[model samples]
Target: MTLLSIAGGIVDDSALSSMASNASTRKTFIDSSITIGGPYNFHGLDLDWEFSSTTTDMSNLVFRSLSYPAEAMENNLDWITVMAFDIGAPTWKPNLTEAPAALYNPFSEVSGDSEISSWIRAGFPARKIVFGLPYYGYAWKLKDANNHGFLAPANGADITADGALGYTHIRNRIIGQGGAITAFNYTFASDYCYNGTTWVGYDDVKSILAKILYAKGKGLLGYFTWRVGLDDNWTLSKTV
Candidate 1:
């Protein structure tokens, strides 16, 4: 059956942090949520708190009275979605263009494989983990159009300030209009397309299928994307 879930959160996690800090407030929040969801016939509530970094913040999350111990999680939670992308960005590595979601990376432990392995090692069951994929990509402005390759010198972000582009935009605007040269980097297990100075690193149909196969091979619960609205006529979604 298709379950309807209500997700609540903003770009920041301060509100969630505050609500998690106190037991009474937390109980009230949960009760109020049920009350709100009852009439709407919602099946579940997903807390998209963005993140909670500090030890206190983390401790307070998911009902502090009963912390999310590994054993409790294994018993209570069906699965967890591991966000495995956003590994490289202009803000993180401004000097060079890099894959935002490389499956494997020789340079550092900053790839999807590393992230999933780390979680598995940390006691989270592999079968209870759903790997995450991105339906979006980051664009970098090549310092020299002729020098377009992985780790190529980049001036910085292109098109948008954040260099983010949805799959539709990349397909229609960049690939369609500019006739971008698309290539799959087998080394990183990532896909990229470039036209002139604009270079974008994202999962196309090829990479998405590869990642899904990888997740299956690793014995993951399944795979999911960050957002569905970014898909190009449901192309990527269909592939997944």
Candidate 2:
């Protein structure tokens, strides 16, 4: 089933309007989502809810609006790809432009309250919400190399491409160049590198496999990567 993925991905008021209870909520989402193949023609929809840590998200708005039409239009959406990354340090710093944090750990303080959880709490089907794992990691300059705790203070950004180091870059460039690439507290299900000044926390084959195993145990819908080009060859993908 070739599903069309909606970009500018946020369940905004316009999208919520699809659930306005007045009329055409399904048509709105379907119209905006599928143009190449009319509503009934396409296989399904893939809700790409990105940048969604708004503290307020919904499913009733979409479920109530899309439920009936979903069946009629045969739009039993392929699955939802939740952007479950970018978890900053434990403490929120207003001035810090960037910080070090696990790119895909679900156990974080805010991970539970974000995309997947919010949607499910709002009543979206768990079996249809495929989890998202970042193929990249965020970098930050450590302020106190001595006290590198979960929420340790950071000097500034890590100054990498987009302030994020991809699996390819991390594996080929960072790992052996400065320091050994190693896993953090094993139980944490993440990896990191501290080459004196730069501290990078990202996912490697071990961590990604662990996450995939964890997802399988939970009966998650499936897995999806942020981008195919980010991984080193097929290291992460094949491992997962």
Query: Could you tally the backbone clashes for each prediction?
Result: 0, 1
- Tell me, by lDDT, which candidate is best: 1
Evaluate residue 139 in candidate 1 and report its C-alpha lDDT on the 0 to 100 scale.
95
- Cα lDDT tens digits, model 2, 52-122, are 33223334333434222333222445456666666653234422322232433344455512555566656
TM-score per prediction, in order, is: 0.90, 0.68
Best by TM-score: 1
- Relative to the true structure, candidate 1 reaches a TM of 0.90
When summed lDDT is taken over every stretch of 10 residues in candidate 1, the lowest stretch is: 1-10
Residue-by-residue lDDT tens digits, candidate 1, 50-112: 566677876776424323456556776777777888888876787899989999898888899
> In candidate 2, which residue pairs get closer than 3 Å at backbone N, Cα or C atoms, i.e. clash?
18-25
Model 2 residue runs over 4 Å out of place are 9-29, 38-42, 49-78, 89-108, 112-125
Count residue pairs with overlapping backbones in model 1. Answer: 0
